[model samples]
Target: MTLKKGIVYALLIASVVACSEKNGTEHPDTATPVATVIESEKLKFTIDTLTDKLDNPWGMAFLPDGRILVTEKKGEIRIIKDGKLLDEKIENVPAVYDHGQGGLLDIALHPDYTTNGWIYLSYAKPGEGGGGTTIARTKLNGNAFIEFKELFSAQPFVDSEVHFGSRIVFDGKGHIFFSSGERGTKENAQNLGNHLGKVLRLNEDGTVPTDNPFVNKAGAKPEIWSYGHRNPQGLVYNITTGELWDVEHGPKGGDELNKVEAGKNYGWPVITYGINYDGTPITDITKKDGMEQPVWYWVPSIATCGMAQVISDIYPNWKNNFLVGALAQTHISRVEVDNGKYVKHERLLEKVGRVRMVKQGPDGYIYIATQSPGMIVKIVPAN
Candidate 1:
């Protein structure tokens, strides 16, 4: 019996040697790091182009049918299916300013989108002399927006072609949070009466929430959630924690990623870590009393745009990383977060051109939108 057991042990040792030396290159059995370099001989990627069905697709929300609803800056929404851009655009899109960086911007579906049928849009509305970012809600009826009306507007904006903080997201409390750009007027961000450069919490019906900090004030606007931001292009709510996070573009530097909270003030122009385009100083102090500092900042500026939390069920290994779209760098930034702190930046797909937005699609894929006859691209894990 002992001799039979020895024979079995010898066979087990021989199997281990075969796995390590014979077939190891093709199927590695030992433990590998999470970011382990793929062996080129054992791996291959199928680069299937999906742009034939895309037209400068801006922001995309994957529909239940596996097709995508994409926005074109020229004020059109097109449908894409099976790696092809549809020529037929959904009609009844609202009129937009379409000047400079303005046009129909972000689109977000209601949290209970399947039942409510409500979709939100952010656009630059043509004002008397200038424009303001207009937030509106509409129901999609047979591929067109219907029953549409303005829910809110960023106020006191000038005629400048810059600074429209049109980013919006749904908070966990069934309320909407949107940002208003500084509009080249720095001081307007600190004012509570007007909405410029402010993160606002609003009811679904467009009225201000009663629990807002300024609701009891004599002349203050009740929708104001947090004040003093620049052109905040990125905003999202963490699904796991329900906490709101945003990233904003600063002057030459001082690009910021902040945790937006109620009633707090984020000092933008008055206490920035950035400088003017011509190297002039914008602010000296990076932090001051009674003013909130950014949770993370880019000293040289990444020209940050849209931000998305990498949920685990979708991208298993990239769970905590907030994918930041970079316009200036023309790359997607994988911002890894560790216990509410910024850890590292992993540049992904640098050759794809200027990334406009990063979003986790409902189809369990990472959707990245690019500008200039914009196109939407999907990121899938290599098998």
Candidate 2:
């Protein structure tokens, strides 16, 4: 059954409305509704509405015990348990700037979370010059935080509220990697003195690793692993291949999917496929001698946010594909990559609302977080 785009939109809207109604008043754990059935090139699947109770959800982390912790842009951490949104927000969350693009952001659990009990968060932290991206870790005690520690704060905090690139991933080697945007200053992406506009590597305890790319480089922040990025809101580390990937926003066009590498420079304003937001060219060149090119890029700017790769076998047809959240386009991009190169892509769940995050749950199902009528939806194999 070939599902037309129009039918998919209608079914998605109806399902969203129905799901909202079911969770609006009582917030009960109702059976998830089949939002829509999608027939892709390889397999058919159904999207199920898990919950519609979030507000501007930015990121999510699935717990080992089947619970999920979600971060809202307004500095709240929410929990979804037994397919229901818990009314009580997690207590003792750090204060966030919550202006423009800054706010509570991505969350991830430590690889040894089951044993160490550390949960990590990246957010826009309020400070002197203004708020900037910060990474912290804490342990949850019931619905509250305990033993909270500030891990890494992006240096020279500025007042700009937009372009706080942030995402967290573990490389399974006792090291963590996170990204920070240029904080609206394009030039900062190329500067080595500041933490902004860079992918940073740190030990689990917030210390810079000795082997980080810039560790011994004078005049550079030791945490920097790669430089020259815009607002990179997505970061994922492939454990099997040890490759790190990032998806970042471009000004007008040229949203990029990068195979991020340590010590490499990803050209941003210096060389972009995009022009300035006001229709002026930032640079006429898209290639530079020493800068790295993107593995894939979007011409019309999808406002890429969170991303995750398919490694589980639950959806064999979607194996090894990347799922990127499309904010401006309001869909999820299923990108097929072959040996570090782009092959083909498809847009899934169109018009479902602004997608903020797409993640694969511990159960091997794909989960998506969207805003407007904030909700979490799941894609499972159609029976």
Candidate 3:
């Protein structure tokens, strides 16, 4: 579907009505939408099938017992045990709106999970006219997630379902960071007061981090660590560098891999390499003076999702690189860096449909979430 500017204008009109219903002030438009195409060599991957298939599984996290937990888009979570899919799904998940891109989003374990027994989740909590992305915590009991409670929710929720931006990861220091999507509102990306389109910092239990970038600012979301993003679904705090990294979706092109920094704006709606899906220009410049440019970006989007830092001590071939999952591109992208600069990007698993999430397993191999009639595949270097 080629998204024309007129269509984008119409979408914005509807968005304004949705926001007005909730009594938010209307702001001027920020940037135009754009569309671009990325074409690269066809790639290949090895798929180690899990025991069970899932329905649009959006997130994956391994429990200490080596059981795999995957969250489905339709609000269900399944447990995979011993390379086999368990037929019974854990119940009592909170109700989700599931409109466009919103549903059960991401899952992560607490750093002290063995002692705390906490499993964190991000989802779209259904509400009156629409919903907003929410970060919550719960405990796992057998196959079920129990004692679930909302730790934080985007306020003045809009009417659209796209761009839920629900990725969660805990830093080494026990602080949590949650990604908030720009809910079909381009102008909101520049609004410091709004919760949408920002990387937020909070304590493990969901209290605002006093050291957050905007904690003392008036009208700014108190938890905002960095601002100006579209839909940031990939977030990981690199253990080696102690830095947070995120990859986000743009309109039709302009996928980005960013080193998420404290207080800096990431330059979304205001500046993008993407245009409206209809092929119009988005921003005048790819780099602005004050706004931070991406550490690396795709002129033609890779439809990037989850990513993880690859660490290898014995194999030593793929160390210190980033492995990113691609939805539109249908591959696991390996990004290599040298001397704090992006060196190269290679694709793995070109025909595997959607590689939703990527993570390094405890046993020293990569695991991926194949969303669809979902398949969880373990990636081992062909030896």
Candidate 4:
């Protein structure tokens, strides 16, 4: 199904109504229902299943040697070498709280990985207070992760298992950044003293950066780089622009794509284009002072998951676009952004199952992780 631009317009109209209902400025939503698929130029490709078996794979990274490392949300790391799924899982992964939304999540490699053999992982650690997002680093040596050390953990871990916004990314510098959800508590997104619903910056060794925006501020968590985000699961740092792009799930609808910047507040419970899952209004206002706006949003959310920039010549026309995995939509949203503006979006890989992660492979093809009989596949030109 192709998504037409008209759907975006109609969604904006409904969003206005949703916002108005919150402020008592309008009665209720009776607008025309928006269509899901936006019509755009479609491409032809053949999906080759590299491996038909992965257990709820969440995130993936391509090794410099063309092998891939995939994270199964069930607290294991599976590796694919020479296009074959290795029978054994990598060892030394810590135990995870694999209930509800908590589990093993995103994984990334150091910029200088070849020299350092360092890899980072974001997982939900079970503790006294249910579970919380945690980041740790380990040495990848001969099919095993050794010398595992905790880098950072969200403070005051809550008892809920939902909204663990745990995606890890390297800033191309020595600094590492990861996101944390509010753990099912909406108001926690606005609290400066907590790590929930915030993007944090830290040195590779888990120390807060001295130049972080919240550093030296009174009563603010010094690790916080940005706040007021919901359950962000997709984070990518654009090497060309040095800008961090993030995508997060919203209640009912209003999934968001934001350009994360230091110290910025991305309105969540305060201002949103979405309402509660029970159809209750979250905020009447979508725009507020001191809150940064999303670059784009989805009404009737796609339940967005993993994301990666498309910069390879293997797909020439897709250069400068982003391949976003849509779990609910079961397609890849090809979003085109130019000069800090979202130009348009198209859907790809229709009927490929619920896409969990999308990444550009070292060989320049597009690799995807899918759920429901979990599998790892790649898209190559239909020659």
Candidate with maximal TM-score: 2
lDDT of 3 by residue, 1-383 (tens): 12112111111112111101113444222212122112323222233545324678888878889887888888988888787777788778888878888888888889888898999989999886689989999998877778988899987588996888989988878699989988988877788988889899899989987888888998888989998899898888877678889999988888888988999988987788898889988787778877988878887888889888878552356688888888887777888877657989876655455778888776777887866425676654434
Q: How close is each model in CA RMSD to the real structure? A: 12.8, 3.7, 12.7, 11.5
Give the 10-residue window scoring lowest on summed lDDT in candidate 2: 1-10
lDDT of 2 by residue, 1-383 (tens): 12122212343334432442432344435334654567767767777766776789999999998988999999999899888888788999999999999999999999999999999999999999999899999999988999999988999899997999889999999999999999999999999999989999999999988999888989999999999999999899999999999999999999999999999999988999998889989999999999999999999999999899999899888899999998999988999999999999988877877889989888988898988758888887887
Tens digit of per-residue lDDT, candidate 4, span 42-126: 4445455566557899988777887788999889999888777787788888999998878999888888988888889999999
Which consecutive 10 residues in model 3 have the weakest lDDT in total? 11-20
Could you give candidate 1's per-residue lDDT for residues 1-383 as a string of tens digits? 01111111011112111111223244232211122222222222122234522434457676777777877766888777776666677778889877877778878888888888888888888888688889999988777788998998787656878877787788757799888788888888888888888888898778888898888987777888889899899999876697889999988998898888888899978889899999988777788898888878887888989888888464566776788988887766777778778777766655455677788877667777776325565665566
Residue 297 error, candidate 4, Å: 0.5
Candidate 3, number of clashes: 8
Which stretches of model 3 miss by more than 4 angstroms?
A: 1-46, 312-315
Worst 10 residues of 4 by lDDT: 11-20
TM-score of 1: 0.85
Candidate 3 whole-model C-alpha lDDT, 0 to 1: 0.77
CA shift of 134, model 3, Å = 0.2
Stretches > 4 Å off in candidate 1: 1-49, 52-57
Model 3 scores a TM of 0.86
lDDT, candidate 4, at 10? 26
